[model samples]
Target: MAHIPIEAVPYLESAIYLPMLLIVLEKDYELIEHGQFKLKRPYVHLIEEAKKLAQRDLQDVKAYLKSHYLKVVQGERDELFTEYHFHYKQILEVRRYSNIRLRNRVEELLNLYLNKASQAHSAIQ
Candidate 1:
């Protein structure tokens, strides 16, 4: 194991989980589109905006990882936790996250990133 930079951890974790978030968002969008709702536009709009923001952030995360020469690889998995291998330069660090924890963290990060994006947009307007 190697010492991983604290600053890089979030981006590395995002790299592992953002795609999962995006897929869930996509499915939710479809479900909302077909499900019963009094006003679907608002829900649809929110999901669309969230999706766009998430996609943009994911791209930024990828670029940051690339520039920093950091790579994250999915490792072994069992019924409980999943392993993620982080590669920086010639060093390798492995982190294990439980399935429940991974889901919770991704949800937290989604809200965090979305709020950050919304705040930045508001400041610009």
Candidate 2:
């Protein structure tokens, strides 16, 4: 398996959404490359769903660092990523959730990451 350092990961809040966001972006890229690109409706819906959460102050310098890392990786300022980048920065500034919840969500997101990976592999096979 490939390795990624903890410090390489963007804002802590991103651990919750970054994987999902990357999956969406990957799908978008695939569709475009296949010349089947539509409006990317599912990606749009995911963004909307993420935005439905109540506003909180999560912005911080650390979050900015992470988001900037992601922007550099993507090499473009797409709307979905840019918005999440902004949100993560906000979250870093002001925490809205408890530690216990944070740990649980991290676990949940790990499962999501694994599930998505498996499904993608199956699709390719």
Candidate 3:
């Protein structure tokens, strides 16, 4: 698993919600004809949960984006400090890692939802 920076967690979390939900629903269609759509699927509940999570994360995302812009004050003297801030690098790392995590979760959910024995029943007669 890759590491996502704390600052970018909410943005990544919110970003995953829709993609995950879409993958779930699309799998139902793609797998249904192949007799692998679950009869008692938790799609509704899963969507609700995703919605809640997205809502929470969206608030954080908005807050972060809104307040993240700030001007750093530099001292007249730069002889004492040589290190510089790496906030942009950290954010990039977080986005990269979060994307990996999202892709992994999508694959996992697809396998679990479409490969279940209980899901081997066809919706179409």
Best by lDDT: 1
State each candidate's clash count: 0, 10, 0
Clashing residue pairs in candidate 3 are: none
Estimate the overall C-alpha local distance difference test score of candidate 1.
Answer: 0.86
What is the C-alpha lDDT profile of model 1 across 1-125, one tens digit per residue? 56878999989988988888888778988999999998998667667777888898899999999999999999999999999999999989989999999889778866875576566566767
TM-score of each: 0.82, 0.30, 0.31
For candidate 3, report its TM-score: 0.31
Off by over 4 Å in 2: 1-12, 15-92
lDDT value, residue 84 of candidate 2: 23
Candidates 1 and 3 compared: the better one by lDDT is 1
Query: How well is each residue in 4-76 modelled by candidate 3, as lDDT tens digits?
Result: 3455544544444434645555565455445655663454444434444435544665566446541112223
Worst-scoring 10-residue span by lDDT in model 3? 70-79
**lDDT of the candidates, in the order given:** 0.86, 0.43, 0.44
RMSD of each: 2.8, 14.7, 13.2
Identify the runs in model 1 with alpha carbons over 4 angstroms from their true place.
112-125
lDDT of 2 at 56: 20
Q: For model 2, how does the per-residue alpha-carbon lDDT over 42-82 read when each residue is reduced to its tens digit?
A: 54444333322211212343356555543212222332332
